[model samples]
Target: MPFQLPDALATSDDKPALSLLRRYYGDAVTSAGAAAGAAFDGWDSTGTRTADVDRFTADDLLAITFLSVRVPPRAAAVLLRDRAAELGDLLAELGPDRDLVGEDEPLTDDCWPGWRLQTALRDIPGIDTTTATKLIARKRPRLRPIWDKVVAKVTGTHKHQWEPVRVALREQHHALHERLVHLHGAAGLSAAVTPLRVFDVIAWREGKDRGW
Candidate 1:
């Protein structure tokens, strides 16, 4: 109801989106061979996707979604045109919470209309505990599990079956997020990983038993 994810990796769309990110952005995980400013985001909504610019790849959903929403007037013509400048401004605003979304344009949902974590993951603000904990491996260049319909296109009984894995990674991500906070401070990080964005990430990894 609120949001969901599949228990297992059932979505083929993930590969396309992820591949697009890896091919174009090369790497979003800086410490893990990814470029410093590279990102691995994509969109799978019923919305149409446009070509990206030289600066950024439009194939990935992040650019597609951002550009689509930010400026739909000429979506077909221009995407990621001023992406670098926009990303720079956003990074300055979100910094530590950079992964949440495009920085200042804080993401929200019916639950967290303001800058707060979801109720389930609120206990761990700036980081959605329930969502991040699922299938998240404990390692550097750690990917904060993102969300989309691919994950929930169907209903799986073993929602979040990777709780053990999630639990293991939760502590690490928490520590890392905290470390980032200490390094960057709360305002930027918290503002960056808004509830909706984080929720989307979590929801993207949903299943039948997911609401845990």
Candidate 2:
């Protein structure tokens, strides 16, 4: 059978690939947490990896919501599980270092892109690379290397440092996200399900309350 599109369907800015996704999924599109929720739900529905000291069972919610953004559907399931496992190891290895790093300096403005990615991830709780990858991708958005907090605090920056209050606030805001959502529409866009947008939404909200 030949294919057709609805009159209301929006074209992808570049790839026809997105159009196909839009035609089928439509407004059935998701809100920000949907994908992570799905991945989390999917994991939970199965009951796979819930141990302790490393309780990353399949049912676990989301290590990092952004992860689903980069992974293709076929690869997502396996990677989600593997990422969760990796997160378990990460938690065991570096998750406790936050205090040692402390709230003292945070991440100042002059830091490199690598510094930016790591600080953002650490600030956001319950996120692993799968979730962090999206944020990393945002900084690079090209799938180069995952610039997560552990790598920065432990590997990249060497010593610990906090970002500037304004910069930290900027990093957390994710202000452009809503625009991206409106331009792309939630359903067909992969970003819909991830924290990629949530980061911005959360930040924008935090900024609004700063008057106190």
Candidate 3:
């Protein structure tokens, strides 16, 4: 089943979940966007080690671990510290390129730079498919989509591997990106929120609400 945004939510028809999410977390999303934009800008201007790590502090990683996926803080800390350098290098490679797929090109595990990052992150002691992708997406928002059980179930890509999800995203990159941008504008989300993040939020929200 190909993923489709529900028309009710698309039009902002006061769906309970969508409305609640917007009311409760809209400000947080806006703040996150601001932080992310500043972080990226700092990285571009000065090659500081902190910038290299996507300006993520230990607190940020811990918050992401617990709030985003309910992972244990201790485990998340170990993974973050151990793979700090590798994560930095991966973000540096992705840079500002949002389009990682080529037209008429076959999508493979090694086709996009994200694949290498995902593979490496997945090998960490406490990381799994969702956590690995989320970590990278936090750093390279434009280039990667955060994945989890909800996203996989909603997208109907039963396997939690990055390859299939990446292929699907690449195929619909243009239209999907456009939709996200439109949604962002309509919702009055901060300009700093990347289209990929908007897309992830919408999918995640819909999936969670509908029990996918």
Q: lDDT of model 3 at residue 177?
A: 46
Candidate 3 stretches with Cα past 4 Å from truth are 1-24, 27-50, 53-59, 70-81, 97-107, 159-173
- The regions of model 2 sitting more than 4 angstroms off are 1-70, 73-87, 96-102, 105-200, 204-212
lDDT of 3 at 21: 38
Every model's TM-score: 0.25, 0.26, 0.66
Write one digit per residue (lDDT tens) for candidate 1, span 49-91.
2222112233432332331122233432222353345432332
In candidate 3 the C-alpha lDDT for residue 204 amounts to 64
lDDT of each: 0.29, 0.33, 0.55
What is the Cα-based TM-score of model 3?
0.66
Model 2: per-residue Cα lDDT over 152-205, one tens digit each = 322222123222221222333433333334434533444423322322222222
The worst-scoring run of ten residues by lDDT in candidate 2 lies at 1-10
Global CA lDDT computed for model 3: 0.55
Name the 10 consecutive residues with the lowest summed lDDT in model 3.
Answer: 33-42
- The candidate that wins on lDDT is 3
Error of 1 at 196 (Å): 17
Predicted candidate 3 versus true structure: per-residue lDDT over 30-59, tens digit per residue: 542232222321132333434444534454
